[model samples]
Target: MQHDEFIIQVSNRAPLSSRDHAELATRATLETLAEPLAGGEPFNASAQLPRGIAEYLRHQYAESGERFSLDEFFGRISQREGVELPDAVHHARVVIEVLSEAISSGEINDICSQLPSGLEPLFEASSQGQIRVNT
Candidate 1:
């Protein structure tokens, strides 16, 4: 999807008040998601995302993943997005749902493969939809 469409989806789905809010949520979630993905995985995922938004994933990559739990993942997103934990989690779910829609199924499947099982809930079919990472 194009960047504007991606942000619009995130904004509408999260029911956020503004485009800026949606952008922040997307950035936070993508950056945090990048933290746990080892090697060039984040770069691989970013390859399919829109240009500027993809940097959120690209900037977070390391030679190896910095292991953390699902809760910790949410914690980081909460901090980054400057929202409360519950909002962060919900926004994250929405961003992930959009991400799945933006990228190919094969790409998303590769992403899911890298995450721990606990984080799997983010990808599970939801009433809202599926997993997303970046714009």
Candidate 2:
């Protein structure tokens, strides 16, 4: 997907009319996701994304993943996104759902390899065809 399309998906999925909000959600989620990604997984995964949106995934991280729990991960995303934890969690799911569609399975799997099973709910729902109705 192109950058606009990717942002649109994030916007619509997040149900936010603000274009900047969409960009922020996308940016924050991706940037935070990069922290725990080690080796070349982040770069390889970025390769599959749109060039504009890809920058968020590239960051100088540790040789190994930055160890943290799923809650702490969302907390960082929450702070970076400037939203509440609940909103951050929701935005994360939206951004990741869009990301799954935007990239190849192998690339996503490689990204997933860096995450522990506990964080699976963030992205696996889309892959498993699990519909989440947050009402």
Best by lDDT: 1
C-alpha lDDT of all candidate models, in order: 0.82, 0.80
Model 2 residue 74 lDDT score: 85
Model 1 misplacement above 4 A: 60-63, 126-135
TM-score against native, each model: 0.88, 0.87
In model 1, pairs of residues that clash are 96-131, 96-132, 97-130, 97-131, 97-132
Candidate 1, RMSD to the unseen true structure: 3.4
Candidate 1 has what TM-score?
0.88
Off by over 4 Å in 2: 62-64, 125-135
- Which digits, one per residue and each the tens of the lDDT, describe model 2 over residues 51-117? 8788888855522477777888789889988999999988888888788888887787777788765
Per-residue lDDT value at 116 in model 2: 60
Residue-level error in angstroms, candidate 2, position 12: 0.6
Model 2: ten consecutive residues of lowest lDDT: 126-135
